[model samples]
Target: MSAIPVTIGRRAALSLDSTPVPAGSPLVDTHGRVHRDLRISLTDRCSLRCTYCMPEQGNEWLAKTSILTLDEIELIARVAAADGITTFRLTGGEPLLRTDIVEIVRRLAAIEGPDGRPVEIAMTTNGIRLPEVLPGLAAAGLGRLNISIDTLRRDRFHELTRRDRLEDVLEGIAAAAASGLRPLKLNAVAMRDVNDDELVDLVEFAIAHDAQMRFIEQMPLDAGHTWDRSRMVTQDEILGALAQRWELTPVPGRGGAPAARWTLDGGPHTVGVIASVTAPFCGDCDRLRLTADGQLRNCLFSTTEYDLLPILRGTSGEWEQDIDGMLRACVRGKLPGHAINDPSFLQPARGMNAIGG
Candidate 1:
């Protein structure tokens, strides 16, 4: 919890200004991609500076006052649930960095989706703090987890994440399995000449722990804006390497799912690959993003952002309807895909952490 390097910016735009709106029909975009998943950033501060995620120093941080409050977070979830967003994932620079995350989970877990089912709440964490917060999170109804762990070697772990917390992360993963966090998974970003050599080892670790593993293609979300396609480890190469050691087969019915899963032959273990760069899945993407500062991103690589704070904080009788209209307009504006392969592509203004991981 010690302070790290950060530059403060205007935060009145980031407050937990509530954005609750009147319940509307299921949110479907112009491309007919219905909004069913919502990724909400709880905070823009993290405990580590992963080389691929953020710079080692001089990164800007949102003032705590500008971060959304627990109430504000819950209200957004409730409104999204009404729009049929049943699967909600709480991400962040590190979601655990938020002091009231447990309460936030408790409130979000209570929301009912349009289908009459309670919203399914999950979290993506760095795992260092899971040992301390896992129990509270589980009790508060967290359905599952995706832990970010890129390396198995302690030295490499520190080198990659800029923190000596690999052991803590491993412990957190173990504790999560023990605590009954079903469908627990590990997220690893596959970068050429970096951690690709350890892909098999990472998958083995997941199999041994009775958890799923997913390797994500490196995208242009780094704070330094240095990502290039040549440096990316594609799904074909990843599968080729893993196939040499294990028998893997694709699992069917992976529509719109970010991860294309495969089962280890004769075993109950599975692994996934999110090839955002080489094998884009934008057509089936059923998700939206809400930054910790209250910016709504229609796509992970969206060039446009809708500021929902003013409408959220507005005091007007028709504000709810107006909020509903805004939601529809934003959804309607969703991009068909993130053109990473296109030479004309440009990265978003915010990094992955600022965009909620």
Candidate 2:
């Protein structure tokens, strides 16, 4: 196939970065699902070119000016907060790459949830630089940390992420623990014949570190778009592997949560498996994604995006009403599921990094 230039018509290419959020009711989709979780991507720039995430090269980077400003991010979040959204997760190509992130946290932490309680703020980072920034982040009101560590073996880590900073990642994990970021979570993407052999060891590492560990089934979010179901290590395989060494028991009430919890017999800590590819929980997925470019995605695999940038940037007198209406429409259009296992599934145009983790 020959490369073709793509362009959005002017009607769809407005910029919005200075709009304010007006008071509103909770954001509810057509299916009667209320939004409570928001994932915001800070930037699309990353330090590691994980094979499953970004390509080795030739990624058409978003123009720096096209990315949302911190103020813009804050305003969207504030509106979401007022709409009963209590949890916000910051993601990135690497969120820590943003220089103004701490200040961003400081501003967001000031927004109260609909319950009048402090909003729960969390982040997912590769952990290479956690040691240097964890303290600042913790003091700025970050409540949870999800560090991505796919392998304990240095060689395997290098093979997976195309980076040899395993030692730095380990140090960063320790720094996160020391900073008192409670309920630390570790994310490992399980790939067939790659790092599958290290699953149990990764869990044990998490147990020793007092962190909750989750093995995520690889999804079709890679920039390469070469995802094959046969290449993924599924949830059942993960459990069977864990059962070989540790007795496993399922935890109750796993609804809406991405990870299905399991108790490790004879151990105080637990482990989880996010079977997104095999057994998706999209029906109860209460999360929304705001891309770094200010597009609102109701579903992770949503083909369409609601652009809020132009509205936020424009001088329209009815910007708030426009935003509120757009939010309702996005929610109403949310698909019941991503339909990845079906033959008719359509891969998202952008990779996971661009979509927000």
Candidate 3:
């Protein structure tokens, strides 16, 4: 496969005389948000071509050599873990598509955090292949799972994903639940006049499956760049729809989590809304994304990307120190918010799949 040429509007320029990061320093940005979550994209390949993610064809993928090797991923993850990164969320076009995913999880799970505990490893997958991989992943210390399912209706699923694999997704969800992945999450992107009407149904399905449902407001992260604000469902609308079906009591203590959760009918079952477009949780954001091709992204909507592949593959003896300095530099440059609602806001060059979910 040929490497796709990415047009990065901003690139982090590494200085030769950059100061070394202080020992045991926490990854904190200018806004004082302590970074910990590391979302790593293992690949840009997916089994399904969802309308909101990418087109069916004409999309160039990264060459195998350009993609980070497992060894490289481990080295970067270890550095982050030592720097106080406690959570690792493995994401991708579909992480299950990686042939060595289980081993990747195992290597990551072995890395201890600053506090001397193994870092938490989670994954966001489309779940088509989860049924086959869930067992090995669970055994390899995969802590949590988030499965994306847009609609409950079979026809709608096909319409949205451009694939007829709703049955496989459901099976994957069932397997995940059976594998004892506690607090299993189901992610559904709520679109206006699309899957918006099924908000209640989605929640009900989640409750029945013993999983928490999260409705996400569609942002301008689609590969097509065709995201329309008018067509995107807002958080308030989702809550309002659920309110008609059941009373939703707000759940407290949502620190750094993208989802603002509420208990349905004041008990047990809960539903969350990740209103990335309307609510904008960048203030509490602690995420740092490593693209499949090894670019470090400070913010989801950031136009800037720090290329770490060169440093990782450099013949220089000070690669570790160089990486540490780059990590610090990346965090220091994080924007306060995604600014998607601002008039000057420009959507990122890469879409959600390439950026990781």
Candidate achieving the largest lDDT = 3
Q: Report the error of model 3 at residue 45, Å.
A: 1.0
Q: Residue by residue across 1-357, what tens digits does model 3's lDDT show? A: 012221111123233345444645788787899999999999999988988889988887889989998888887887788778899999998999899999999999998976789999999998999878888999999999999999999999888888999999999999988888888999999988889889989999999899999999988998889988899989999999999988999999999999999999887999999999888888899999999999999988889999998888876645556676778888888888988888999999898889988
lDDT per model vs. reference: 0.83, 0.83, 0.87
Clashes of each: 1, 6, 0
Q: On residues 1-357, what C-alpha lDDT tens digit does candidate 1 reach at each position? A: 012111111111111234332345777877899889999999878988899889989988987666777766676676677777888899999999888989988989988865678989989998889999898999998999999989899999899888898889999898987878889999999988889999999999998888999999999998899887799899999999999988998899998789999988856889999988888889999998998988888899998888877766665534445445556667878888998888899999899999987
Query: What RMSD value applies to candidate 3?
Result: 5.3
Q: Which stretches of candidate 3 lie over 4 Å from their true place?
A: 1-20
- Cα RMSD (Å) between model 2 and the true structure? 7.1
* Comparison by lDDT, 2 against 3, better one: 3
For candidate 3, list the clashing residue pairs, or say none. none
Report the CA-based lDDT of candidate 1 relative to the real structure: 0.83
Pairing residues by index, what is the TM-score of model 3?
0.94
Candidate 2 lands at a TM-score of: 0.92
Descending-TM-score candidate ranking: 3, 1, 2
